[model samples]
Every structure is written in C-alpha cells, then in structure tokens.
Target: MASIRRLVLDVLKPVEVATVSFARELSDLDGVDATAVRLVETDREVQNVTLVVEGEAVDFERVEACIESLGGTLHSVDEVVCGEFVPEEHVAHADATWLR
Candidate 1:
C-alpha cells in the first residue's frame, strides 16, 4: 500500500488550546515531519482551522486522536496525498475548463 504523505484537514477546535501548541503536538507525532495550522475562522467558543500535515507516512488515526484529545473535532478531510512521492500542485489554465 502507498504511504500517506500529506493530509489537509478542516478542524474545529476550542479556543482554549493555542494554535502553536496544537501544531507542535501534531509535528511531534511519530510519522509526521511537519505541520502547518492556519486559522480559518473563530468565535467565542471555537476556532475553525486548516491543518496541513506532511511526513513519510502520516498516521491518520493518531492525528485524529490527537485533535480529539485537544478538544477539536474533525470537520472534514480536505485533501490527502498517498504515494511514494508528493506531487506538485498545478494550476489549471484559464482555457482548461475540463480540468477545473
């Protein structure tokens, strides 16, 4: 099976946990190499965040568990990359309606 190389998740987290701490904990996961947490939206009780995680073989279960432990809910898996290599993203040309 191909290894999971990257994951982009939409998460909702309690404001109590700082983004820095949440990102740091994700980066510390066994198979994770790095993490990028972007604040998408926020309210008095929760924050909507986009979490990007990259690694040689990211463990989705562990990532999900960590988020839950930190009072977060996984809203959706926005993106996922699984293979021996991570593919570069390409922008669709204006004339390429089919690609879009």
Candidate 2:
C-alpha cells in the first residue's frame, strides 16, 4: 500500500470562521481527509492561517483549489518533512540540535 504524506497550506483570510469552513469543505473532497486541523492563535490579527492536511500529494492541487473556491486563499504550501513523502529527513541530536 502507498502512504500519502502531509501537505501544509498557509492561507490568509478576513475571519477565523471563514478559514475553518474552508478546511471543513476540504474533508468532503473525493480523496482528501483531515488527519489534523490546527488554528494558531496570536494577539496580532490573523493575516495567515496554516492548515496541515495528511493525504496523497497527487490530490494536493485539487484540494488547494477547493480551499480557494470556498473563499479562502492559499498563500503557500509546504510538503511535510517525512521519509515517505519528502526526500529530506529530519534528525534530532542529544543536544537538541536538528539536522535535515
């Protein structure tokens, strides 16, 4: 079986609920599922919201569009760092230094 990696999307919007609704619509996509949905809170007004989605990368673009169509605009996408999907490997040392 093939394993899909996490796709991280950064979106900017006017309201928090708007972003949540966009994420909700993503769950209903043909091959998209939400492993996790996180909203980072800050005192500063939210100009950017990050959504981390776990699934096949093949469907990433379509899902991205769905998010945009739902009135949320995607600002950037970062491929999750994991062996199965992204080629890079992240390593932690005993001293807490990280290597990728």
Candidate 3:
C-alpha cells in the first residue's frame, strides 16, 4: 500500500478553538509527524482553514475523527502526497514564481 506522506485539507471550524490547538492535536495522532493550519477566511462564527498534515503514513479516518471532535467540518481534500518515498520540491529562489 502507498503510504500517505502529506495531505492538504480545506476545513470549516468554529472560532472557539485556536488553529494551533488543532494542529497540536493532529500532530499527536499516530503517524503524524507535523501539521500546519492556516486561516483562509472567517465569518462571524466559523473560520475557513487550510490544513497541511505530514506523516510517514497518515491515518485519514483518524484525522477526520479528530477534526469532528474539535468542532471542525471537512470541506475538501485539496492535495495529497503518498508513496513509498515521496520527493520533496526544492526551490532555489524565494519568489512567487508559481503564481506568475
């Protein structure tokens, strides 16, 4: 089976909890090496967030459960990286080249 090494998710969550707290909680799960959550947009009661999770083999079911437990709704899976050995992208220059 191909191991899930990276995942990018779009989530909608209540504002009561902090994104860092969610990241910390996700990082505590099995196989999760790290997590990064960024606020994309916000309304009065909820925040739209983009979540990036990295692991040797990410348990997606557990991750979804964790999100629900934290009062978050999974919107969509934007990106995913999975394989026995996933290659990392390295950029020589720090510029918005991809955007141009």
Candidate 4:
C-alpha cells in the first residue's frame, strides 16, 4: 500500500494559536516526521495559514482532529504526496500529464 509522504493544507485558525505550536503539535502525530506552517494572511480575528506536513505516512484524519482541537478549520487540502517510494525528481516536476 502507498503511504503519505507529504501534505499541504490551507487552514483558517484563531490568532491565539502560534504557528510554531501548531507545527509542533502536528509533528507529534503518528507517521508525521516534520511540519511547516506559514502565515499566508492575518486578521484581527483569524489567521490564514499554509500547512505543510511530511512523513512516511500521514494519517489525515488525525491531522484534521488536531487542527479542530486547536480551534482551527481546515479550509482545503491543497497538495498531497504519497507513494511507497517518492522520488525527488518526481516531486520537482509534478505534472498530471501522465494521466493523458
């Protein structure tokens, strides 16, 4: 079976939650080796963030729960990286032309 190597998400969250704390929390999830959180936009009430999660196999459900528990909402799953063996070149040149 293929495993999830990476995931990128668009998230809307309250301002109280620090991105570092959020990233650290996600890093603790099963199969998640690392996490990167970037603040795309910010407002008085909420923050828009780009979340990048990487690991051998990322359990998305758990990730969602974690976000919710932290008073955040997952707006969308923007990118996903999954395979038994993901090559670096493939990641660099990700085109859906193979579907043709």
Which candidate comes out best when scored by lDDT? 1
Q: Candidate 3 on 36-83: residue-level lDDT in tens? A: 999999998999999999999999999999999999999999988898
Best by TM-score: 1
Cα lDDT tens digits, model 2, 16-97, are: 4565576677777665556345665433545566777765543667776877676666777765433365565567568796
TM-score of 4: 0.83
User: Arrange candidates by TM-score, highest first: which order?
Assistant: 1, 3, 4, 2
* TM per prediction: 0.88, 0.60, 0.83, 0.83
* CA lDDT, every model vs. true structure: 0.95, 0.62, 0.93, 0.91
- RMSD (Å) of each candidate, 1 decimal: 2.6, 5.1, 4.6, 4.1
Record all residue pairs in model 2 with backbone atoms less than 3 Å apart, i.e. clashing: none
Deviating ranges (above 4 Å) for candidate 4: 85-100
Candidate 1 lDDT over 1-100, as tens digits, reads 7889999999999998999988999999999999999999999999999999999999999999999999999999999999888688887778566644
* Model 4 worst lDDT run, 10 consecutive residues: 87-96
Give a tens-digit lDDT track for model 4, residues 1-100. Answer: 7888988999999998888788999999999999999999999989999999999999999999999999999999998888865556445355556665
Give the Cα error of residue 38 in candidate 4, in Å.
0.3
Candidate 2 lDDT score at position 90? 63
Model 1 accuracy (lDDT, Cα): 0.95
